[model samples]
Target: MTLKHILLGTIGATMIAAPAAFAGSVTPAPADPVVATPVAVALTGDWTGGYVGGQIGFGDVDAGGSDSGAIGGLTMGYDHDFGTWVLGAGIDYDFADITAGGNTLENMARLKVRAGYDMGAGLLYATAGAARADIDTLGNDTGYFAGMGYEHMVTEKISVGGEVLYHAFDNFNGSGTDVEATTAQVRATFRF
Candidate 1:
């Protein structure tokens, strides 16, 4: 045979036989469909319930002079949130013995209204209200108070916070003395 005729015949025969030679070899099966796990979505907190908690901190009373001591108390409140703003009413009572000028003051109470900016897991608030205190030998006295506080939600039902309050009482029960007091406290609350 001529060289060109031989080469063409060999090439044509190889091409015709190649597919048949590999037809019995392993063929890959179609892959199984992948199943994906669903992801959990994070939810934001809502502060629209009644809460009760306790607090402990230091307080300084300046009636004529100044006296500083430790103070602890219980707090309870109900809050209504309006999107970014919150309005609430609360009551708190403290057991403290702060002395100034040989007189000891004990047992303070407050009826307060709170206005706050909601920060998702936290609150920045301003409070104004009425306060009352019992003097050692003197009767109970009433006053006005103003303060600011910050509270953070530790969980869905738990929160921790702190506040600084200034209280002013004029003519403390006919004693002819005006009382001005400041208190700083750390507090925790449980919501329902």
Candidate 2:
């Protein structure tokens, strides 16, 4: 035979006999579906239900006639979650060292409302409420506040966050000095 015919015959013979020569030990692959074990994940903390916590922070309040340096305060609040809506109401007390002449300021209280969403990792919220703080020169000036905050959960029962608030104040003591106050604070909350 010619070289080309011999090579072709060899290739044809190999192809025709290859499958049967290996058939004695050839095993079919399993056709079963893969079963993955379900993993169990722990839920750390839920931002639902009634929550009460206290906070202390510093703030500056300017009421046109006088400017307050640094104010210290305490706060308590309850927050409720109705799935998509997180509703909260709280109050705070602040003692400010603000005086233009010779008057000492007393305690300031604020009643606030909050609306927010708990986005798995943290709680993102916006707050607004009526605030009234005592002044030496102007008595009590009532105002409103708008702010935003993010609470990162560090544990099952503890979270820390920072927030900024803008306050608009009414004129006091006929001074026509409406004030805008902004405060930034780091806060830690204990969840029970």
Candidate 3:
């Protein structure tokens, strides 16, 4: 072959072999570093706080000897939350026309101290408080109450609930005795 043609052939062979020499030996160029932007979340917090609400209660009252009547009225209260536990105290006032063995009561007031556990879906709770009832004759006075309740979160901003309670009162001036009573109620609460 001519020298020029030989030189050209050598150059072509060198060019072909150069890429093969580098095929497995070269490191790929580093990819551009990716920076991710943080995303903000709208809602995050412990649903533990103080709440105030009013409720209507239905209860039976036993004041005089074997006395019973339907009672209902208003309730106001506040609650404190620590994670899944709730501690609360409240006062409920009710009025009922109660009569038994020639006795009648006009207005009754019952105060309660309550505590509960939040099971995520609802609260399992118990309450105890003071009860006082009034009669036209001499203002019959007494104290007693117990209850178990469940409060459910029906919405993000509201809660609806139900409860069953037992009550007792002592008429110190009338018969020197305590009487048994029962109660049930439905309630709703708004959250902020």
TM-score of each: 0.78, 0.64, 0.63
- Arranged by lDDT with the best first, the candidates are 1, 3, 2
- The digit string of per-residue lDDT tens for model 1 on 57-161 reads 998987767889998999999999898999999999999999976667798999999999999988999999999988775567999999999988888889999
RMSD of 1: 6.0
Ranking by TM-score: 1, 2, 3
Model 3: weakest 10-residue lDDT segment is: 41-50
Q: Model 3: how far is 110 from its true place, Å?
A: 2.6
> Pick by TM-score: which candidate is best?
1
Q: Give the per-residue lDDT of model 3 (tens digit) for 1-192.
A: 899999999999999999998786568778899999999543322335544444555656454555555666666676676767888877777667776545566776677778888677577889888877676665667767787988877665667787778866665456655555677777776665
Q: Report the C-alpha lDDT of model 2 over 146-168, residue by residue, as the tens digit.
A: 89887767777777777777777
Clashes of each: 0, 0, 0
* CA lDDT of every candidate: 0.90, 0.68, 0.69
Q: Return whichever of 1 and 2 wins on TM-score.
A: 1
The pairs that clash in candidate 1 are none
**Which segments of model 2 are wrong by more than 4 Å?**
1-45, 65-68, 98-106, 173-175
